[model samples]
Target: MPLILFNKPFQVLCQFSPQEGRESLADYLAIPNIYPAGRLDADSEGLMLLTDDGKLQHKIAHPDHKEAKTYLVQVDGVVDAAALARLQAPLDLGDFVTKPCKAVQIAEPAWLWPRNPPIRARADKPTSWIAITLEEGKNRQVRRMTAAVGLPTLRLMRSSIGAFSLATHPLMPGEFVEVEAEALRVGG
Candidate 1:
């Protein structure tokens, strides 16, 4: 089985399946016999994993593995400390209590590539940056977590998944790379 690391772009579905009137894995990934290990939402962007190995996919996608994932989130509000603190604490999502996670404020930088369709800008209001890390990724967890605490995620980008990081390789929108399968092994 071979492993591939990709920095997915905005509006791209995480699968090869056809998305009506929308972009999907087919638009970006050309490698044969590879499938996404997990997913990043179509509206969200950043590090994605692909592999031909079923076991590897399960190891990365299954919550039991508790593999850490990190994201750089831009929120609509100022995202005060109180909100940031709540992100680090457990969240009650009705079905279950989310595990504690990590979050911190980050200064804005000009290095990130501009999202193809940029988030709407509010003249009076402003955007803020937050770095969030989670061991278990629930559906729209980061977005939901932020929304629960009064800040809605305006934009989201997964910077890292387990050992692989986008900062190191620097994937522009719609670009990806194939890494040695062993490089993505959790405990190799």
Candidate 2:
């Protein structure tokens, strides 16, 4: 079995199968028989784990395991204590209620690479950075959470999953590395 860590860039589709005009995993990764353990939408960027093991993938992606996934987000507003507090609470988000999660305002990470097409810059509109850790992965949950708190997400990055962190394993966008598969217990 092979385990891979890939730094997926913005605008690249999460799937390996080719899509019209958009770049997909195949454009970056060549190793066969491997699939992403979890998915980050094309708009989001950062660390992703891929493996050939089905059980390992389920453990990583399934909400049942509650493996922590942290996101470093850039929101459109100047985040305040109130906004952070709201994010940490189990506020309703229409279709479903989110689980309580950790949300804190943070300084922009020095390790961050500029997006291919940088986020919009406005002299009067200041942006804020936040680090949020959630056990359940919902579609556009981080973005929606920030928006509900009045801080629309300008950029979102999945920096870590469980013990693996992009901060420790820095790879430029579109780069990937193969690693040991023993990191997960799938034999049970």
Off by over 4 Å in 2: 184-187
Question: Where's the lowest-lDDT run of ten residues in candidate 2?
Answer: 179-188
Q: Encode model 1's per-residue lDDT on 83-144: one tens digit a residue.
A: 98888999897777789999999986467888878789989999999999999888899999
Candidate 2 lDDT, 1-188, residue by residue in tens:
66798999999989999988999999998888789999999999998999988888877788877778899999998999999899999979999889999999999999899998999999999999999999998899999999998999999999988777887788999998877766543344
Q: In every candidate, how many clashes are there?
A: 0, 0
lDDT at position 124, candidate 2: 98
TM-score, cand. 2 vs. native: 0.96
What would you estimate as the lDDT of candidate 2? 0.90
The number of the candidate with the highest lDDT is 2
**Estimated TM-score for each candidate:** 0.94, 0.96
How many steric overlaps does candidate 1 have? 0
User: For residue 41, what is the lDDT in candidate 2?
Assistant: 94
Model 1 TM-score (2 dp):
0.94
